[model samples]
Target: MTAPLPSLRARVTPPDAVSPAPTHGHPPLIEVDRLSLYYGAARALHDISFAVPERLVTAFIGPSGCGKSTLLRCFNRMNDLIDNVRLEGTVRIGGEDIYARDIDVIELRKRVGMVFQRSNPFPKTIFDNIAYALRLQGLRRKSEIADIVEQSLHQAALWEEVKDRLHASALGLSGGQQQRLCIARAIAIKPDILLMDEPASALDPLATAKIEDLILDLKQQFTIVIVTHNMQQAARISDATAFFYLGELIEHDATSKIFTNPARKQTEDYVTGRFG
Candidate 1:
């Protein structure tokens, strides 16, 4: 039998609480207002608006090529890597406009970490994989680095499995272990927002379940945004869900409502497995 769904605490703030004035003293952690993106002459996203609250899991779900990954990349300005990619309107993190000229993209990315679909661990040892980011920031204390490596691995739920093999090559790990190691690496810097782009898509079922459990556990300390095509996984893990269609935000609401009683007919049909 399937395990019972975990009791969902009321952590999602209402849409009105995410007003521009910051009502209830809880400002949104990330805000996208009338945001549009383009790759040279081709527009990818049109006028999308949403607010992601702190310390919660928000998921983006839709059919393939619906701009879910595109919008997730905008949170940390990953689109900047694409030639002539342009953004209109604003994407603000921690009340600071990320698109502003003076903003430091490197620091912005540090605050907003990401885990990609595949497990792309470095060729170095497991300990070095987790230490790579900390070392780049000029942290030289050996004791501190060791402590952080253990702490991050524990947070990612991999410490017990790999503690004895910290010196082993990361490339030798199983696919699931490598993916968890990637998560530990991302969390090592203690980012406030973690963006996952189909992070479990390449994993097996057991590995995917472990990643889902990690996502559920990590929300107490970090805000998470997940882009997923797996409807069941979205419903199981996310506190809130957003449905995108052809680069537009078709609907967004609580995960339960989105799955059971969506306000839009399109969202209902899609959730009911009628059509994407």
Candidate 2:
């Protein structure tokens, strides 16, 4: 018989340990230098700056519409899809300017994956949902596609739950399982950075806890940037936390410091439940 699979809890890295950077002394995996965004006449983000180290979880926290989601989309240029949406400054991945004239948007998105607030699985079989990207890339061998599908599901911490029902429609899964399927689909492309916008906000307590555990495990292999409303979740899961308000980044520091004793009053007040 095959060896028993490891438990999801066992795959998770301890909260206190830091995953190594993808490369040594090089620039961060993602760099947002003085970045700003606008929708027609209104500005959404202003002079936002931060560097996301590889294999680490960086959480963005703020009140609703503080531009946390907007900034998260900027990493992969999702804003480009909106008409008259203007972007200023630079967002670099692996030291390459993503906004440069020569960049390919399709390939860029493949390199920087995103998971939205709500889980969106395709109207297809669970296996196809995970294999879609690879199929689009012209992968024809059935065995190869199957291997990657299983591997991606394993990486997203969903293998055991779905392995027996790969032929079932993706919509048949629970909310939490659907979200994990989305994560599996995103990682199937082997992205270098994963952007999550309130990934756990819609789930129940138990489901949310499972996602938090999955995020911690995922960071061992992928750089994660999440926008969350839960201060305790941020403190528990993120290695670094950035606090934003009124279109400005108030503070960016280690998660512990930001939670216990922030350098800025706004951060302190926000974390201490005084104000959002």
Candidate 3:
């Protein structure tokens, strides 16, 4: 078997330790079993099953509307907010079904933060943008919020650029900065998992590179699942990659395997630029 990518394994495991994969016999942090989803009458995902390892970067790569983002939303239950959305089967985080009765979505959101394709900083100061989620959870102490804000920004690799102007309006920053600020805001609440949907699709190459680097750094503390059409980006940073097609999971495996020797003809075709 191919070894785990060093950059990923080194972040959360000791050197010489076996990298985590379900096929490798390591238990997964997130489990999707025979799961299907529908938006009103239109089915979006069909019987998808996969296990995501903890503290590793998992990339979902496919063409647009191929159910990559749909599955990413399942991790945090974002689909629940949309009307007429229906799901069959189970999505389990830490072995507990998130769709089960009495699950506190607010708290679930706190544990599973999301960053959108577009940079969305509230029309507030950068400081407030990062502190909003904390405040909503009743963190009123200015010192506490300030500490977390600084830490999260550092984690997102934006603190150095904005530390001197944190109180300024978030809208004043450039597009890349705003995206990093959004990431900082998401991490400020210290989520256990992060779901990013084409987060760098709107940024220029430089900004996209920065976001990619930040993602590499983040896996030390959070399990990250990203939806991207950029096949190269998925290969660059993810430990595992899942390919979706027409609301079905066509292939999922280690990133190196998927990119280098994909098992499915469709995954091979998509990754090789034959078709998307």
lDDT by candidate, in order shown: 0.86, 0.84, 0.86
Q: Per-residue lDDT tens digits of candidate 3, residues 1-276?
A: 112332312223222212225344435888888888999889999777778888888999998888889899888888888899999989889888999999998888889999999999999999999899889888999999999999999999999999999999999999999999999999999888999999999999999999999999998899899999899999998989988888977767889988997766677788999897
TM-score of 2: 0.89
Candidate order (lDDT): 1, 3, 2
- For candidate 1, write residues 1-276 as lDDT tens digits: 111222234333233323232112434789988888888888788777788878889899999988999999999999999899989989999889999999999999999999998989999999999899889767899999999999999999999999999999999999999999999999999999999999999989999999999999999899999999999999999988888887877777778878986766667778889897
Question: Between candidates 2 and 3, which one is better according to TM-score?
Answer: 3
The estimated TM-scores of all candidates read 0.91, 0.89, 0.91
Q: Give the residue spans of candidate 3 off by over 4 A.
A: 1-26
Clashing pairs in 1: none
User: Which of the two, 1 or 2, has more TM-score?
Assistant: 1
Question: What global local distance difference test value does model 1 have?
Answer: 0.86
The C-alpha stretches of model 2 lying farther than 4 A from their native spots are 1-27
- In candidate 2 the C-alpha lDDT for residue 263 amounts to 62
